[model samples]
Target: MVNELSSTLSFPILIGDIGGTNARFALLTDAFAERREFPVVQTADFPSIDAAIQETVLDKTSVQPRTAILAIAGPIQGDEIPLTNAGWVIRPKTLIGDLGFESVLVINDFEAQALAVASLSAEDREQIGPGAIRPAASRVVLGPGTGLGVAGLLHAQHTWFPVPGEGGHVDMGPRTERDYQIWPYIERLDGRVSGEQLLCGRGIMHIYNAVCAADRKEATLETPADVTSAALAGKDPQAVETVSLFATYLGRLAGDMALLFMARGGVFLAGGISVKILPALKRPEFRIAFEDKAPHSALLATIPTFVVTHPMAALAGLAAFARAPQHFGVATEGRFWRS
Candidate 1:
């Protein structure tokens, strides 16, 4: 149950989407006003999260945010939340004290992204296939960035609930000849390949290397950007093949996740990488792979897929939580104001 005070957000609530590389901030004051996007901050530029926020938020606005919600990368457990891909450790109490906020919320990045699905407008997202969102049904968000992130959202009891987990770490192995060929390359790097092994930034590099080895070509690409740029421009055949397989594998995994949650509501292709490779994702291979699952192929095909184009989607999700805590499966205990 929400206390009378917790039932509504304090004015000018602060929402942040903190990632491994960049930290995005937004301010939600007027419910009717469009959410303002603050300048993106480099995570490496600041020594701590608090310092970054202090410089980017408090110092600029000159107003202490009474309520704050943070969507961070990694699991949300205990007092100190360690970022999976970053060196930052978020301590809610420290932030509350330092920022002088009455409440603070820290949630897994994907969980927040999942919640954003409800808040996203038509312009905020781009549909990848032919289908419409099933009203009030389960929805899931998955993305390939520095790491793969996954989460689901369901509506029950008149509230949108976020289901967060480490689904990205699940084992992913060879399913096709191309995948089998890539396995040996991945094995050489991380002994055991997880779903993120071939779907993430470094994964692109890995796939590029595997393609080169399989075809006896030079593994000239050094970074994920290099591979993506080459593939997009058709500058390198191996790079192009790497991206194709990446999309194919990502589609299959997305379909599996859809079955897991029965996410008829929709599946959002979030994260920076998806936006960068929008053209590639639009290819038929992606939709084909997503709908290739037998016994449920038709069902999966009916479930729509989209790439989240809005940069501040997580911030919007946080804002939604602040407006109505009951709308999410979030619990308020101590410094944990939102899940």
Candidate 2:
């Protein structure tokens, strides 16, 4: 059970941002001290969370942590929490017993992203288009990586609330004539395509292959990087088209999310793909498609969008919460555990 009066975490906190491919860890010695971050390690390299923390953190640092705050790339439920795209399962009870931590708090990865949106500095993000941020209004953050992630940040009662959900799996269908022509060739998950199907890393390759199929040409690009490189270099027309269509679809999704929450604060893009495709997102195609909504086009134009530039955005967010939990209203009824 959660202790409503226990608003502060102990000193020497362990914060982690665990995703499908990589896991990053950091240590906060005290309330005012700066976070000490360690090098990133692949999730596949470690069998479990404790092993990774043992080798990457405990083995290297002498600082012992009293509590842990982890943000994983999946929903937080039960003692055995499994990642959506990764193979490892996190057992919080096991972590406390093995690591000698007093308590553990688990949150959805995108929830951490939303927390970052609330606390990030101006230079931590780069604006993609023209619009002003309404300070007290709600905001949204979504990203494309090993999979898609979406979250909302609501401001109420002088506190920031991070709302996490499986918004990445929302339905997405073709709208443009070009999209219709290429849709048939694009692979489907269970006979239909979700937003992640065409907006993630594999989605890049899917778009490339579909564009090739539509154009009656053999696809030579093997990876998403190859497609993006070719497109950025203007060396392959197919690669260029794939990236353009990707930007358009991403914009459409961003616009939809903005309207859903009435996110006048801003819509932030945070992930490995969003950072890599900064140039593509900055192009006219992204903003144009974002503002193409018929009735709310003007409203969307007034709402800003940004690419989170912080390298360890999730860690920063967790650090923020660790420093001052009272500032953010993160739900921890079932997610918080203590021994």
Candidate-wise lDDT, in order: 0.83, 0.92
TM-score of 1: 0.93
CA error at residue 339 for candidate 2, angstroms: 0.8
lDDT of 2 by residue, 1-339 (tens): 123514546879999999999999999998899999999999999998889999999999888898999999998889999999899899999998999888889999999999999999999999998999999999999999989999999999998999999998999998989989999999999998999999899999999999999999999999999999999899999999999999999999999999999999999999989998899999999999999998989999999999999999999999998888888888987787788
Clashing pairs in 2: none
Off by more than 4 A, model 1: 1-5, 30-34, 187-190, 333-339
**Reference-based lDDT, residue 282, model 2:** 99
Q: What C-alpha lDDT, on a 0 to 100 scale, does residue 258 get in candidate 2?
A: 95
Q: TM-scores for all candidates?
A: 0.93, 0.98
Q: For candidate 1, write residues 28-134 as lDDT tens digits.
A: 77556566667999888988899988899888886667777888889878888888888888988888777787767677888889888877798999999977898
Which residue pairs in model 1 clash with each other? Answer: 160-327
**lDDT of candidate 1 at residue 240, scale 0 to 100:** 90
Top lDDT prediction, candidate number: 2
